[model samples]
Target: MIRMIVKDLRINPLRTGLTALSMFIGIVALIAGVLVGTLGRDYLEAVNARLSGRTPTYSAIIDVTSVAGMQTTMTLQERLAHFEPGSASAQYHLNDLAIWASSGDGGLEIRHVAVTVTDAERTRVMPAPIIEGAWLTAADKPATLETVVNENARQYVHDGTITLARTGNPQQVPARVNGVIVDGADEPVIYVNAAALQRYWPQAWTPDGLTILVHPDAGVDDRHAKTALDDLLADVGAGSVSSWNRSDNADEYEQVIDFLQLGVIVTAMLLLAVSAIGMINIGLAGIEQRSHELLIRRALGATRASIAAQVIGSSVLLSLIIALAAVLISASLVWMVPWMMPADSPLEPPAYPYTAAMIAAGASVATSLIGSLAPAIKAIRLQPALALR
Candidate 1:
């Protein structure tokens, strides 16, 4: 039966080739859709990680004008300063104080900058890619203020000593620009360690904003961490706290990607449906033209079931071959994507999506079986006596 099916398919090379080509296009489309969706989601995630930190990150603003708020802020600050790794509480907590400062070559030309005084944990909580130099460290000198400037600020500040003073204040302190980072900010921004700010400029040490980051590997769920933070704030009698999770924003982006993927897959499936319909039409026409041959097989003691199986088997085999070729081609393209991309590109290509290949192969076989059913039945119904007449 297998040999007979192979011989029948070989006799009509053009028809078989065209049918395989059509199914191959559909399979390729399915694979391409999945690859595109996976890569896009990965790229978005990487960008989000750099811009907004990793998943399960929380941001809050603490009002420090009241006595209770001030006490609570101090308590939180203490917890953050001595935060232990793998703790039940949040992984890293950062207190940020934004203030206006002045820098530049002190010859009557001053560049006003926005300075964010934060704990050294800011580097770990919401890490930015360092364009040059290094991030703040716990071992940094306390006597002199060391700062990391954003890309926008690097134009005015070099990797050397620059006089930094509060805006409108003549008491200038020398600050060293230890590093430069990409913070995605438009204006010039400087990052200073809160400890150094407290030691040198005690006036600007008060924080107005707070950031809480829970590492995914910390073995603590988001609900428990949030609840623990709420309890801590309640115990310290902190003022109104407004907090938001970064996962909410990430979910919105994910939903958009999922919708796009669904659309692409649906379109690809429609193309597959068209290919299947075309195959069915061609199969029925071939059956009509080969009625005499089928009659001869029946006269030679071939059962109706064997004839049907032979017709369907030929389609399944062709579809399997096409699916294998398409998957190989798609996998090759996925493997070459990283090399094709520019080195400086921010997004790194993800690995091949195996699930997509499996789906494409399965869908191809199913389509072939469905498209061959009618022709198989038609081939079996052919009468030997009528064909001989």
Candidate 2:
């Protein structure tokens, strides 16, 4: 039966090819739809991953004001415990100072280094990518003054230390560089435990802001979390605090992804439906043109069942060919597309979904079968003697 169907398709190559091409187009549309849906979700996942690398989980850095009367570690802890239940907290200060760096010419080069005084949450939430050594932990300080410097600070750090000295005051503190981190900055930056920095340089240090790590499924989202934090700060006369707005952005991003998915699916469905209708038309025309041949076979003792099967089998063969072509085209295009994209583009090229290809193939064959059913039945019901005339 398969050999006979193959022979028939081979005999009318042009007609068969054109009908298969229609289904092939539908398969392409289906593949594209799957890519669009998959890519949308993949894009979101990539964005979330990038953001997660930069930002800490359930963490927010808030602005503190003088009206808050210099937030102390003890005070912030009490406020967090009272309002934001089931949450963790930390404090950080972003400061800057001019440090004397070795210029490699044996001359001193003045480099401006950004300093951050952070609690354990610094490592927890916004953990920088560690390139060398280990990250700073709560236990890292008190025993020795340790600092994690960014890659930009490598030049200034000699003998595992850097000198911090102002113009008039010759007093210098040589901080031991514990680790090197990738902070995505062009300038030298250093992170140290807040208590250690303040304890050493009482006059140079000041509390800047607070960081809070919210827990997962903690019965609180960003808005509610922010509101709770704000209310707590306000009650303590902290005025207003600034946050990264991660929650708001995440919600908006998800909505956009959903919209893209819906559009792709609807468009693909329409294209597939049109293709199915076209295949049915082609099937009916083929049956009519081959009526004489079919009747001759029937008169030679072929059963109605065999005649119907032959017609349906031919449709299935055409669809299989179409599916093969679609797979080749889609795979090639998907593979080569990333090379054509710009280097710094935001959307990462998506991995081709093999499962989606199978679905497309299945849908195309099913449509082909349905399209050929009526034509097959019509051919079966025809009077063999009359058709043979």
Candidate 3:
């Protein structure tokens, strides 16, 4: 049976090959669409994760430099002192404003920054997607006056040492420029440990800046949290608080991607419909051309089941070849994404969409079976006695 099917296809190579090519085109299109859709969604999710810290947390900055705001800042600091990490409402960080001038090759660079001071370990409030160097850690507390600078201030550090001058003193203070945070913010920010700050200016170190963190599953709604915070600060006469909330941009992106996927799916279905029609026409023509030969086989005692099997098997074989070719081509394109992307691009190439490819392969097989069904049925119903004429 296999030998007969091969011979039949080989006899009309042009027609068989053209049918396979049509199926291949449709299968490839479907696979490509799925892969691109998955990649687009993954990229958007990555961006959101980076920007929002992937957690339900709020960082509120309060101004406490004014005489009126000082009492509020101190009261908030006292309250935060009792709060512990991993609690429902945790105080992530507390810092005070510190201004210093650093001498570098490009003259003196004056930095207006808020510095984090705590016995507890404090992490980056808003970490950048791309960090050039290491962040300040709890272990770095032993190193006196080590500071992490923003991307803009990185130029002033020569040989890891930057000479900083305090406002009141004539003497220059040299501090180690540990790392950089490139969050695209214009503020020249610096985060230093409290122990380190006290070592240089013991009396000036105070908690003026605060960051409140909440667990994603903490069950605390943003409105309630904001209102409670407002009352707490108002009671102590603290200045108005500025908050950073997670943007709904990611949700918008997901909706857009869903629409794109739907579009791709519709387009792919249309292409497959065209391909299926072409295959069906080719199958009918082939069957009609070989009607006389098939009748001779039936006269030689070929059962109707055998004849139907032969027709269906030929379509399946053609489809299998088309599916394999389509999968290989789609995988090759997905693999090339990373190489084609820019070096600093935030998006990493997505993995091969195996699930999508398998679905596409199944669709290809079904298309072939459906397209050949009518011709196979017609061939099976033919009577040898009448066709012998």
Q: What's each prediction's TM-score?
A: 0.72, 0.60, 0.65
lDDT of 2 by residue, 47-165 (tens): 55333422224556666664223345435544554444434445565444457776779887666577665554454344355668876655332535567888777877879976765
Count clashing residue pairs per candidate: 0, 2, 0
Top-lDDT structure, candidate number: 2
lDDT of 1 by residue, 1-389 (tens): 77887887897888898789878988888888777777777666666765666554665444433422333444655565454432222222223333323435444444555766555566555557676787765533343567888877766564375556554555666677778787656788787655555566665444444445543336666666566555655665654346645442577577877887788778877888988898898889888878888899898888999999999999999999899999898889889888887543446666887888899899999999999999999999888777567
Clashing pairs in 1: none
Whole-model lDDT, candidate 1?
0.68
Residue 47, model 2, lDDT: 52
In model 2, the clashing pairs are 56-125, 63-242
Model 3, position 121, has a per-residue lDDT of 26
Off by over 4 Å in 3: 55-131, 139-207, 213-249, 288-303, 328-343, 381-389
lDDT of each: 0.68, 0.69, 0.64
Candidate with the greatest TM-score versus the true structure: 1
| Model 3 lDDT at residue 282 | 91
